[model samples]
Target: SRVSLVVVLCLFAFCSAEYFEEEEEFYPPSRFPIDPDANRTMCEIIQAKGYPCEEHYATTPDGYILGMFRMPQPNNVGPPVLLQHGLLDSSFTWVLNYPEQSFPYILHDLGYDVWLGNNRGNTYSKNHTTLSIHSKEFWQFSWDQMAEFDFPTQIQYALSKNAMYPKLVYIGHSEGTTQAFAGLSLNSSIADMLYGYVGLGPVISVTHMSNLWLRDLLELGVEWIWNVLGIYQFLPTPVELHSEFVWACAECPICCNEVIELICGRHHGAFNNSRMNVMSGHEPGGTSTQNIHHWAQMVKNPTFQKMDFGAKRNEEIYGQTTPPVYNLNNLPKSLPMMLYSGSHDELADPDDVQTLVTTLEGIVESVYWKEVRKYAHLDFAWALDAVDEIYIEVTDIMRDWVEGI
Candidate 1:
């Protein structure tokens, strides 16, 4: 009897262990193939498009083969406008809802090729020639790397492909604008290649008014967990275990309710759950392992300068501890640039944009701060109603600028 009991116990233990192992394997350790059906409303609009969007690869100086999307202009006439997406989002985020809106599509119709860039560490740009995604080298990059390496390579590649053009215009949103400034400031030669620059909801300052509570929670949570795990670095992509943890907290019943309350206090009463769902992507998107480190630098030292790692590293590469802060004081005295803002955009408040404008050395030949009475940050890209008004003004500006050039 004792011998039989022992055998049965051993069999039960083996079965339990096997079941757990299979369960773990079923949910691939990565976060790819995110649930495309969770937020049906948002996915309905995003997935409606059947456009032929192809992915192109470019290698950085560091040999990172970054992923980019080439949305060919319908007629292919004007200079290609490099479309830089915001933090944590891949190029697909730019055209995910293309069929419903015509901003990007209109640009295509107007003969402007749109080359959307995906920054390092995003899902699309996940491979590197020398570094493995699991290594610290992969996570070493930040927005600084994007400005110094990614943008220059992408621009040169774009201009090389379209050799007929001497200059190209730029449209960057959020951190995209930050990197644009960093690129121009570090390599003035690239500045000569730009016909005009348009920054939408630019993130020059880290002192955000909206989304304060959520941002705080994220920073605190990351700091605590990373410290506990003895992980001093950022995750390479949002598929890792850490990324999952952060997302769970952000979307937790209590945390999400608190976030809604905060947004409501900001007078954004109609906070669409679908928008939040979409912004987070099919899974929790944009939680780079190195993101918190870079963000720490940005928030701790609120300056429009290149990352403040110290003069030695900066000088070795960028020639200064602080890359010139888009020396608004040095902008071509007559350069025509446009700065647009949303009234309810807490990230890039109207005051902040105005302050940035004032820093420009030249009198901005034209300025249009779209105080879309109720528009917020995400709405600049996702709001169905705001796109028409935005595209009309944007395309008109581009037409005038291109004509002048």
Candidate 2:
């Protein structure tokens, strides 16, 4: 009887620890079979997955053609929300994880009309009226142009389509937040139309950032690198480079995780590791070197403001010795805003977020502080449990605001 009991216990332990075959079947949709080429357009990917998606094109005042995607509601009976992607990322960021977990999809499932913005110079928004992609003029823009031109154009376009919705909700990540702040600063009238703004990993002041190497690089200056390498586009992913990285990530997932950990913050297993290959296709999508230089300028500068163009040029541009700061205090107190930030985000450090919070108390509404402990920067998009830990709460808050609850 004792021998039989021992054998039964051993068999139970083995069975409980499922083998690779069984575990593989349970991996999330982000795991494998992601076609980078086929999924280039947001509509294509969403339609492929049995969701309704529509592509809308908007022309910036500066003549750049920006692409925005819409997941139209079934009966036009939902609040409109516009989501913008971060630096070197496209609209695809929102839909990287499983449909149930993705923010855009969740918003759609919750009866929100969702729109995704693609900024100028990304893979989707690469075309301009007269300027060729190879011309230096095409690569001359920074987040400033994105704010003054792209943001307003896209917002107006979305507003035009969804006329019934008064005052659209704006949600932005990383550089997206920067553009909104800049746009609103330049034209506070824009704030009059926004019902509320939700910022994820809002990056404004990076002078006190935690990334030491990046900080050092900023201090030293990044303009010289562009000149030395003759690089017009910063970190442009050639088709070969994209494919190679994707293939490497797929074949050696552990190595890929280590690389991300070394560059980004400690993962703490927050990100869905298997989806790195899927993410690689869209990341480092494309950006002008000038834009990166602008960020470097932000890091080196003491205040949250416009890009510095040296004393002489600054005098010419701003009629001052130094580039005047964007007046954060100028924002309307009635314009509702909320910020979502992670504690471990190296780029948008918690301290920097605190600075923003302290500075922007006038227009601040509700804030969802770091719910997931030790969540890093990219985890906002890639964290496997983000739906449960982050999105659900965000949706609840936005729902209340939409319903006037």
Candidate 3:
């Protein structure tokens, strides 16, 4: 009888375990490519339209194979636009929010071939040839390595295949803007290839922003946990966390509800709750959960290039006690660069945008500091009522620049 009871207990435990496992599998936490079917559908539709969208792999100098989407221009257009996404975002981030009216679709409509770039460490760009992501060596890279290596590789490969001029027009958002500046400043070869530069919600400095309280708390938590785990520098995976904030955000509407409330309360003063809901969804757009961790690293350690190791290392790098501010001296004195900013962007203040523009060496022929009086950072992409205004302005600016070229 005892032996029979033991067997029954084991069977019951196994069945329970299998049941939970099946339940978890049925409901995946929200992450990028939110709907795989939606992503596959979009890819299929793009291909069916005859533009030839293919998955292209770009190997970083460090031998990381970054997944990229190549949308060839119709009739082999010259000098394709290299579209780089912001932090915690993949190329799909561009297409997800404005499935019918985003920049990529609009640019494609305007006869410009678009190639979307996904930097290393994102979900799609996580493979490495020589190093494991589980190791510190993989996480050692920052925006410095991206500008110096990844951007150049993508541009070179694009140019080689098109048989067009190597220099291409560049468009980026947020960290995308920062990487563009770093790339142009450090790699003059690539800089010269850029026909014109466009930045959306550009972030040069965040000394004015004050939305970092939650980030500060999270960083402190991560540091303490890492020390406890005997892992000093490596990032922790979502699966090993105390809370499933990432997963919750994916599967639970309550998480999105809280995020919308927090963001709206902190930034969007007097904005409609319905509009706020739409904006919060658009801020993250279609970024994956893992990408969010990579962004946390940048927020914790914001440097134009890489982390600074204090006075001695600064002296070694810049030949001075204080490290030079990212060597902005190399930025083209007369390059036509366009910076767009929202007035209420706490993260990327319009004032700071102006400061960045003024600090640049030469007279930027055209500077449109659109004070979308009611505009916030999230609004740039999400404002259901304001996208047309934003799109028209951007299209006009690009059209003028193209005409000049």
Of the candidates shown, which would achieve the greatest TM-score relative to the real structure? 2
Q: Give lDDT tens digits, candidate 1, residues 1-405.
A: 244333422322332121122123323243323334333332243334543354578999988888776665444445777877776555555554444463566566667766777778766777899887656567676787888798878777766666557677788877788787777666667777777787777777665545453355344544445445434333222232323433443354345333323422242323334334333433222434456456555655557665555678878867766644545443443445666677877666767676766665344455455556666565555556645647667778878767522
Q: Compute each candidate's TM-score over C-alphas.
A: 0.72, 0.85, 0.72
State the lDDT of candidate 3 residue by residue for 1-405, as single tens digits. Answer: 244333422322332221122123434544532322232433553565445676788887779888778777656774477788765455755654443446666677777667888777764676789987556556556666667777788777666666655567788877678778877787665756667787877875665554553254334444344334433222211222212333344455455555433432233422233222222232332222222334444455544444444689768866777534566667765567776777777667676677787766244454455556656665554455444656666667666655322
| Predicted structure 1: lDDT | 0.58
lDDT of 2: 0.73
Ranking by TM-score: 2, 1, 3
Give the least accurate 10-residue stretch of model 1, judged by summed lDDT.
14-23
For every model shown, the clashing-pair count is: 5, 0, 2
lDDT of 2 by residue, 264-318 (tens): 4455425666676766666655677688778877777758666777899889988
User: What residue runs in model 3 are displaced by over 4 Å at the alpha carbon?
Assistant: 1-52, 214-224, 227-254, 260-305, 311-324, 361-366, 385-387, 403-405
lDDT score at residue 28, model 1, on the 0-100 scale: 27
Q: Looking at model 3, which ten-residue stretch has the lowest summed lDDT?
A: 233-242
Candidates 1 and 2 compared by TM-score, better number: 2
CA error at residue 342 for candidate 1, angstroms: 1.6
